[model samples]
Target: MTTQANVDTRISEPDAAQISEFLRDHPDFFDTHQDLLAELRLPHSSGKAVSLIERQVQVLREQNETLKSRLLELVNVARENDRLSGRMHQMTLDLLAASSLVGMLDALEDHLRNEFKADVIALHLPGLSETQLHESGAENLVVNETLKELLPTPLCEGKPQCGRLKQQQLDFLFKDQAAAIESTAVIPIGHHGQGGLLAIGSREVNRFNPCMGTLFLSHLGELLSRMLQKHTAG
Candidate 1:
């Protein structure tokens, strides 16, 4: 009772599910017919059709390039860190060789200016004798009890702070050069904020930020504090 037209209408194309099932069950089919990988084309983002193998090769090449770029970046970072470490060590040695507090401060300022690229370096030490201050040219030494109050509470707690300071605070530290400062890193020296602070200021706004790492600066502060204490004790 089936006519030729009815027979033609009854035939159906394979659905996506059937094709997927067949491919899943015959996983080795592509291995056996490797030419099919080259024959099958996928639409690329560039509106060009690329063979499956070509697409896979392109993806691998891109990943390889990314890895290479990342590796180079790491290498550059390591080299930079090594250079900075060398400079820091050399600065420490110079500080140790310094006989007087002025010599130590001069060394610190010189290294910070030449190596660290700081625009201004100031150490505000409290309780230093007038004679010592004048002899050392330590104009930044406040020697007053209110110096700690000039800094924020967090920094007063003996923490390193980095960011833009208020105009008044900048003036308190840098004086006339305060107008030129855009950013700063304030490293607290001594235990319980007794000794004083080391201020590093820059003309660039982005030179120091709140999120910058303080580990190295903190270690430098401690080292300088011990040196100061020893000098003062003598």
Candidate 2:
């Protein structure tokens, strides 16, 4: 037979998980044993012992601060989205007001350079010949088979290709400006990209990261496709 003292010594102390489970099971345990809050001490970040209640208050304060920071971030994102929408609305009005293909191209170039912060812009449409486009006043906006090849790839589907492009891809799109462009947004224009493509180059590397959302690009592609049809038909 084991001695009573030996049996008491063998009793396992509850682990942190066990204590957490017990508290979860009996939320009202504190109601009955409120005095434990004063007796129990916890190690704080400042390397000092604090009563359980004080530690809990500190934890709650930290959590409250984290929540506040997250809320502010969400607010800032919402404001940015609102600003982008307003700019898109203005661009649409400008596109509608354009009288000809050259007018549309000039309007797009102006908006991208001045308002949208784009460093260089290139457009490639399949139906129109290079000579015709150049005569219409579009320089470096070539009509090429590259647009057809790119549309079938994952990079140019509904999602579009963003961020740093490969050496060959950059050379084909940007030409002389390829080395200067740190990042690019390649929007597939027209149905299944049959109409062509639009490339917006930026000097900043992070301007078009792969992880960024492409919903805006998809909308832009659709808008450009429709606008091109209106002009190219005439």
Candidate 3:
């Protein structure tokens, strides 16, 4: 039989050993629990937060795309503007070139050839009043073969040739030669009282139409007239 004291001791002794072991492990276990609790309790972003960030990114992307499209439109407009500006600049140069005396005829000829592409150009000065073609003693006046033939007989008869020749008169004189001369622009090359005529010819029938703007030619004509007046008086 076991003694009572020994039985009690066995039960109490096991209980005391268990208490000591639990005390020894308590600090380490508490530290582990604290780390786990910290992990669980720490701030955790949900799917909603990620979704919000993605939405913001998408909005920014759309804004960037819109900006790029606007930028491209501006670039295209700028290029077109530049092209138009260049054309205008060239036209201005052509106009300026046609406003001088020597340069006027040269520019007019070039413009007609390069711009309007005319075939022939003739400048004519009718005799002044009291100045007979035969008696005026004006030689070395540039005349083509056709004009020489037309003016010779009437001029020998001592007819007065002052005053502007009517358009009808020009039409009558050149009517038969229409087949060879497709188009004609008879521009008066001076102020009303003292100017001569510039006859521009083109092989193309539609080159010198009535509807064409005469502003440039008119200014050039005035310059030519001034030059002629100076030369005649000198």
Candidate 4:
């Protein structure tokens, strides 16, 4: 028994000579076996370590894919937001460009044509009454054929004249023949007695709704009416 005990101890412990010889023969053997030696030395009660590691790797891969999808969605949404913001900025710039009555009308027509896509735009101003005109000079005011038909006979009996019959009350009309006209907004221009009207037509029915306030168009109309009054007076 004593001999057997001595033999077991000799097998378990490396002699100094044997250790030196092994190290000289394979210098990297210890490095290569370091992790394996450590794992072998640990208690087996730690459970299925390989299975746990594989499950962790799978969970990490799934999380990475989810994160990648979320990042892509964010990028797409940001691009769309930038596009819409740019369009809104351009519209604001166009609205600010209106200065004179003719310019305002041109701008409005352009907006309707380009943005709202209207079919036709028309403007009408009532004729002067017979009593206001000098009988001798009245014949000159009745030349406008369409105006002659629309106005009362008394207003156009003598000369063809552009008549201002009332305070800031200008009649405007817009017709969309294609039934493609989706929406219309009649904005009265000017303050008190100085303004005319702005009629906007759109090809989309829901484009204009009663819920929308008249602030922007009303201000534009007032500016235009003031310019028109100045032009007429001058």
Candidate 5:
């Protein structure tokens, strides 16, 4: 038989799991036992004892700091998005004001080089020979049957593609500038790819990658196709 002293000691020293489960079940227990909160101590990383209230305050402070950091990051992203939108709006306005295909191409090239930071800009319009485009004052324009085969399935479906290009594709698109280009964004203009395809090449190998966002590229292609249609109608 256990003595009264043993019974008292057993009641005071409950199993760890029992205490943990009890606390987990009764989260507000400390709220009711306000004095016990101040009495409880936790081992500090500095090998010193800290009051439970102090430890809780430290944890809350750390959480607050983390939240502030994330908020700042979100704010920076929003500002950057706003800046990009402003530039894209300006570019659209410039494109809309173009009176001819030459003007349109000039606006496209200028905005892409200055705003989008493309190192090399090349265009391939099918069915139109280089001589025909050159006669129309578009000497930089090109045409190649291999361009159709080089386009990825996404581009065939009228979507933009971003990533490193094969040497053959780069050579066909950039031509003389192929030696300098390391990556490229290939954007197919028009729904059926009749308008043409635009290639924006970069010297940075990782600048255009498969993971990059293509929303801007898609919108740019649509705008270009519409502009080309106007030029053709004129």
Candidate 6:
């Protein structure tokens, strides 16, 4: 009842699976019939017919390349972390060495510009009184009694915030540079912002984003908080 066409159709690909299973079950079969290795011709991307052994080697080479790339990426990241760590240490020394509020601000601005690559820096110490500001020689220090009210919800609760901010918030922090800034980071200095707050602006849109880790920012805030309290206290 089966013609040549039907016979050919009946010979499905399942027989190949059976053959593969048989080969796997009897590894010695390949030892007995070493001639099969020469019959396996795999087409490569370069349009060349390669032997089965060569194909396996090529695949392994590709996997090795992928692993190497990943390892290189991790090494680069580690190097960057080390660089950031060194910069942070220098900043700590600068802040500690500051004799007055003006000196502290100067240290902060210099490090931010040279080490952190920040486009604009805004330090807000709304807790300080006008007399304190005058005495500390911080006439240019940004102060806002209602700064907490103007912040985003998370920042209001003393969270580190990053990414694109609303125009009003940008204007509040960076004033002249607000329009030029494409991204910003808002780091809370202390509880209720009694110490102060820091706003770091960048011209690049992706420079500051919500997904970035806040560990460094948190450390920066804590260090600044101690210095601010020391310098601003009566």
Which has the greatest TM-score?
Answer: 2
* Distance from true location, Cα of 155 in model 2, Å: 6.0
Alpha-carbon lDDT of model 6: 0.81
| CA deviation > 4 Å runs, candidate 4 | 1-104, 115-120, 126-172, 175-180, 192-194
lDDT for 88 (candidate 1): 91
Q: What is candidate 4's lDDT per residue for 40-82, written digit by digit as tens?
A: 4322235544443355466799999999999999998789667
Best-first order by lDDT: 1, 6, 5, 2, 3, 4
Tens-digit lDDT string for candidate 6 (66-86): 999999999998998999999
lDDT tens digits by residue: candidate 5, 76-186: 988988988999999999989988777888898999999989998988764555654784433243333454566754345667878888888788778888999988998
Candidate scoring better on lDDT of 2 and 3: 2
Residues 1-234, candidate 1: write the lDDT tens digits. 999887777665677898899989998888999988978999998999999888989999999999999999999988987998899999999999999887888888899999999998777777788888787655545534476577754245778889998898899878788899999998878764467778899999999999877877888888888989878785
> Please, what are the lDDT tens digits per residue for candidate 3 over residues 1-234?
899998998877757778779858685764656554433332224533333335556679999999999999999978966765565456447645543344444655565566556566555565443343333222223334564344432233222232223445445434444345666665555543135556666667676665655555565566556655654552
Per-candidate RMSD, Å: 6.4, 3.2, 29.6, 22.4, 5.0, 4.8
lDDT of 2 by residue, 20-43 (tens): 999999999988999987799998
Clashing pairs in 1: none
Q: Could you tell me how far off, in angstroms, the CA of residue 121 lies in candidate 4 after the best superposition?
A: 3.6
In order of appearance, the predictions have TM-scores of 0.76, 0.87, 0.36, 0.35, 0.75, 0.74
- Residue pairs with colliding backbones in model 6 are none
Judged by whole-model lDDT over C-alpha atoms, candidate 4 comes out at 0.48
lDDT of 5 at 111: 94
TM-score of 3: 0.36
Worst 10 residues of 1 by lDDT: 136-145
